[model samples]
Target: MLTSKQRSILRSMGNELEPILIVGKGGITANTIEQLDQALSARELVKGRVLPHTEWDTRETASELAEATGADVVQVIGRNILFYRPPETGRSPRIDLSGEG
Candidate 1:
Protein backbone atom coordinates (compact mmCIF):
# COMPACT_ATOMS: atom_id res chain seq x y z
CA MET A 1 0.00 0.00 0.00
CA LEU A 2 1.00 3.61 -0.55
CA THR A 3 0.40 6.75 1.41
CA SER A 4 -1.49 9.57 -0.23
CA LYS A 5 1.57 11.81 -0.16
CA GLN A 6 3.68 9.16 -1.82
CA ARG A 7 1.06 8.53 -4.48
CA SER A 8 0.82 12.24 -5.15
CA ILE A 9 4.57 12.48 -5.56
CA LEU A 10 4.65 9.49 -7.89
CA ARG A 11 1.72 10.83 -9.89
CA SER A 12 3.53 14.12 -10.38
CA MET A 13 6.64 12.31 -11.50
CA GLY A 14 4.60 9.99 -13.66
CA ASN A 15 3.11 12.94 -15.54
CA GLU A 16 6.35 13.46 -17.43
CA LEU A 17 6.82 9.80 -18.25
CA GLU A 18 5.51 8.32 -21.47
CA PRO A 19 3.89 4.91 -21.46
CA ILE A 20 6.56 2.25 -21.79
CA LEU A 21 4.17 -0.52 -22.70
CA ILE A 22 1.02 -0.63 -24.76
CA VAL A 23 -1.82 -3.13 -24.50
CA GLY A 24 -3.31 -3.83 -27.88
CA LYS A 25 -6.05 -5.98 -29.34
CA GLY A 26 -4.42 -9.10 -28.03
CA GLY A 27 -4.99 -7.75 -24.58
CA ILE A 28 -3.00 -8.83 -21.52
CA THR A 29 -1.12 -12.09 -21.90
CA ALA A 30 1.45 -14.21 -20.13
CA ASN A 31 4.16 -12.74 -22.28
CA THR A 32 2.92 -9.28 -21.49
CA ILE A 33 3.01 -10.11 -17.82
CA GLU A 34 6.58 -11.36 -18.12
CA GLN A 35 7.63 -8.16 -19.85
CA LEU A 36 5.85 -6.12 -17.21
CA ASP A 37 7.65 -8.05 -14.50
CA GLN A 38 10.96 -7.25 -16.12
CA ALA A 39 10.03 -3.61 -16.43
CA LEU A 40 8.98 -3.40 -12.79
CA SER A 41 12.25 -4.96 -11.75
CA ALA A 42 14.12 -2.26 -13.60
CA ARG A 43 11.84 0.63 -12.80
CA GLU A 44 9.85 0.70 -9.62
CA LEU A 45 7.20 2.79 -11.30
CA VAL A 46 5.87 2.17 -14.80
CA LYS A 47 3.08 3.61 -16.89
CA GLY A 48 1.13 1.41 -19.26
CA ARG A 49 -1.15 2.62 -21.99
CA VAL A 50 -4.22 0.70 -23.05
CA LEU A 51 -4.84 1.04 -26.75
CA PRO A 52 -8.24 2.27 -27.83
CA HIS A 53 -8.75 -0.93 -29.76
CA THR A 54 -8.12 -3.17 -26.79
CA GLU A 55 -11.07 -5.29 -25.80
CA TRP A 56 -10.28 -5.51 -22.12
CA ASP A 57 -11.74 -2.99 -19.75
CA THR A 58 -9.29 -0.51 -18.24
CA ARG A 59 -9.81 -1.56 -14.61
CA GLU A 60 -9.64 -5.22 -15.44
CA THR A 61 -6.43 -4.85 -17.35
CA ALA A 62 -4.92 -2.77 -14.63
CA SER A 63 -5.86 -5.34 -12.03
CA GLU A 64 -4.43 -8.17 -14.05
CA LEU A 65 -1.18 -6.37 -14.73
CA ALA A 66 -0.79 -5.34 -11.13
CA GLU A 67 -1.37 -8.88 -9.92
CA ALA A 68 1.04 -10.35 -12.45
CA THR A 69 3.75 -7.82 -11.82
CA GLY A 70 3.37 -7.84 -8.03
CA ALA A 71 2.84 -4.11 -8.22
CA ASP A 72 0.42 -1.74 -6.60
CA VAL A 73 -2.03 0.29 -8.66
CA VAL A 74 -1.07 3.88 -8.18
CA GLN A 75 -3.61 5.40 -10.45
CA VAL A 76 -5.66 4.82 -13.54
CA ILE A 77 -6.42 7.83 -15.66
CA GLY A 78 -8.21 7.53 -18.94
CA ARG A 79 -6.38 4.79 -20.82
CA ASN A 80 -3.24 5.03 -18.77
CA ILE A 81 -2.40 2.98 -15.69
CA LEU A 82 0.33 3.55 -13.17
CA PHE A 83 2.00 0.63 -11.34
CA TYR A 84 4.59 0.59 -8.57
CA ARG A 85 6.67 -1.96 -6.70
CA PRO A 86 9.40 -1.45 -4.20
CA PRO A 87 12.82 -2.59 -5.22
CA GLU A 88 14.34 -5.70 -3.78
CA THR A 89 17.11 -5.41 -1.17
CA GLY A 90 15.15 -2.47 0.14
CA ARG A 91 17.33 -0.17 -1.92
CA SER A 92 14.50 2.02 -3.11
CA PRO A 93 11.25 2.42 -1.24
CA ARG A 94 8.07 2.93 -3.21
CA ILE A 95 6.49 6.24 -2.45
CA ASP A 96 2.71 6.36 -2.63
CA LEU A 97 0.97 9.71 -2.58
CA SER A 98 -2.48 8.18 -2.74
CA GLY A 99 -2.34 7.80 1.05
CA GLU A 100 -3.67 4.30 0.78
CA GLY A 101 -1.17 3.25 3.39
Candidate 2:
Protein backbone atom coordinates (compact mmCIF):
# COMPACT_ATOMS: atom_id res chain seq x y z
CA MET A 1 0.00 0.00 0.00
CA LEU A 2 1.17 3.53 -0.68
CA THR A 3 0.98 6.32 1.84
CA SER A 4 -0.79 9.53 0.89
CA LYS A 5 2.61 11.23 0.80
CA GLN A 6 3.96 8.63 -1.60
CA ARG A 7 0.93 8.95 -3.86
CA SER A 8 1.37 12.72 -3.81
CA ILE A 9 5.01 12.43 -4.80
CA LEU A 10 4.15 10.03 -7.59
CA ARG A 11 1.36 12.30 -8.82
CA SER A 12 3.88 15.13 -9.08
CA MET A 13 6.30 12.91 -10.95
CA GLY A 14 3.51 11.74 -13.26
CA ASN A 15 2.64 15.30 -14.30
CA GLU A 16 5.72 15.49 -16.51
CA LEU A 17 5.42 12.02 -18.00
CA GLU A 18 3.73 11.40 -21.33
CA PRO A 19 1.24 8.58 -21.62
CA ILE A 20 2.95 5.48 -22.94
CA LEU A 21 0.17 2.93 -22.52
CA ILE A 22 -3.16 3.41 -24.22
CA VAL A 23 -6.52 1.75 -23.57
CA GLY A 24 -8.84 1.84 -26.51
CA LYS A 25 -12.38 0.73 -27.30
CA GLY A 26 -11.24 -2.85 -26.86
CA GLY A 27 -10.92 -2.20 -23.16
CA ILE A 28 -8.51 -4.28 -21.06
CA THR A 29 -7.07 -7.34 -22.68
CA ALA A 30 -4.46 -9.99 -21.99
CA ASN A 31 -1.99 -8.17 -24.19
CA THR A 32 -2.66 -4.93 -22.42
CA ILE A 33 -2.00 -6.54 -19.05
CA GLU A 34 1.19 -8.09 -20.35
CA GLN A 35 2.44 -4.79 -21.69
CA LEU A 36 1.66 -3.00 -18.45
CA ASP A 37 3.38 -5.75 -16.44
CA GLN A 38 6.52 -5.35 -18.48
CA ALA A 39 6.40 -1.58 -18.14
CA LEU A 40 5.98 -1.80 -14.37
CA SER A 41 8.93 -4.12 -14.06
CA ALA A 42 11.12 -1.81 -16.10
CA ARG A 43 9.99 1.68 -15.10
CA GLU A 44 8.18 1.32 -11.74
CA LEU A 45 6.19 4.38 -12.71
CA VAL A 46 4.01 4.30 -15.83
CA LYS A 47 1.52 6.71 -17.36
CA GLY A 48 -1.39 5.47 -19.44
CA ARG A 49 -4.32 6.95 -21.30
CA VAL A 50 -7.84 5.68 -21.97
CA LEU A 51 -9.46 6.76 -25.18
CA PRO A 52 -12.77 8.55 -24.79
CA HIS A 53 -14.60 5.94 -26.78
CA THR A 54 -13.76 3.06 -24.51
CA GLU A 55 -16.60 1.19 -22.81
CA TRP A 56 -15.04 1.53 -19.39
CA ASP A 57 -14.64 4.92 -17.79
CA THR A 58 -11.22 6.29 -16.89
CA ARG A 59 -11.44 5.36 -13.20
CA GLU A 60 -12.65 1.83 -13.94
CA THR A 61 -9.98 1.36 -16.55
CA ALA A 62 -7.31 2.52 -14.14
CA SER A 63 -8.59 0.17 -11.43
CA GLU A 64 -8.72 -2.84 -13.70
CA LEU A 65 -5.29 -2.13 -15.15
CA ALA A 66 -3.76 -1.57 -11.74
CA GLU A 67 -5.29 -4.81 -10.42
CA ALA A 68 -4.24 -6.76 -13.46
CA THR A 69 -0.66 -5.51 -13.30
CA GLY A 70 -0.36 -5.50 -9.50
CA ALA A 71 0.44 -1.80 -9.60
CA ASP A 72 -0.76 1.01 -7.38
CA VAL A 73 -2.92 3.74 -8.88
CA VAL A 74 -1.04 6.99 -8.42
CA GLN A 75 -3.65 9.19 -10.00
CA VAL A 76 -6.18 9.41 -12.79
CA ILE A 77 -6.68 12.81 -14.40
CA GLY A 78 -8.99 13.08 -17.36
CA ARG A 79 -7.95 10.27 -19.68
CA ASN A 80 -4.52 9.87 -18.13
CA ILE A 81 -3.66 7.34 -15.43
CA LEU A 82 -0.52 6.81 -13.42
CA PHE A 83 0.65 3.47 -12.01
CA TYR A 84 3.52 2.47 -9.72
CA ARG A 85 4.96 -0.89 -8.68
CA PRO A 86 8.16 -1.98 -7.02
CA PRO A 87 10.51 -4.00 -9.15
CA GLU A 88 10.76 -7.73 -8.70
CA THR A 89 13.32 -9.15 -6.30
CA GLY A 90 16.96 -8.39 -7.10
CA ARG A 91 15.94 -5.43 -9.28
CA SER A 92 15.95 -1.82 -8.16
CA PRO A 93 12.81 0.29 -8.27
CA ARG A 94 12.99 3.53 -10.23
CA ILE A 95 11.09 5.67 -7.72
CA ASP A 96 12.09 6.03 -4.08
CA LEU A 97 9.21 6.02 -1.57
CA SER A 98 11.10 5.91 1.73
CA GLY A 99 10.00 9.43 2.65
CA GLU A 100 13.56 10.44 3.43
CA GLY A 101 14.93 13.53 1.78
**lDDT by residue for model 2 over 41-97, one digit each (tens)?**
888999999998667799988998998888999898899999999888897767888
Clashes of each: 11, 0
How well does model 2 score by local distance difference test? 0.90
Worst 10 residues of 2 by lDDT: 92-101
Overall lDDT per candidate, in order of appearance: 0.85, 0.90
TM-score of each: 0.87, 0.92
TM-score of candidate 1 against the unseen true structure: 0.87
Off by over 4 Å in 2: none
* Candidate whose TM-score is highest: 2
- Model 1 agreement with the true structure over 1-101: per-residue lDDT tens digits: 88787788888889988999789999988888988898888888899999996677988899999987789899999999998888888575554444455
Q: Estimate the TM-score for candidate 2.
A: 0.92
Which candidate's lDDT is highest? 2
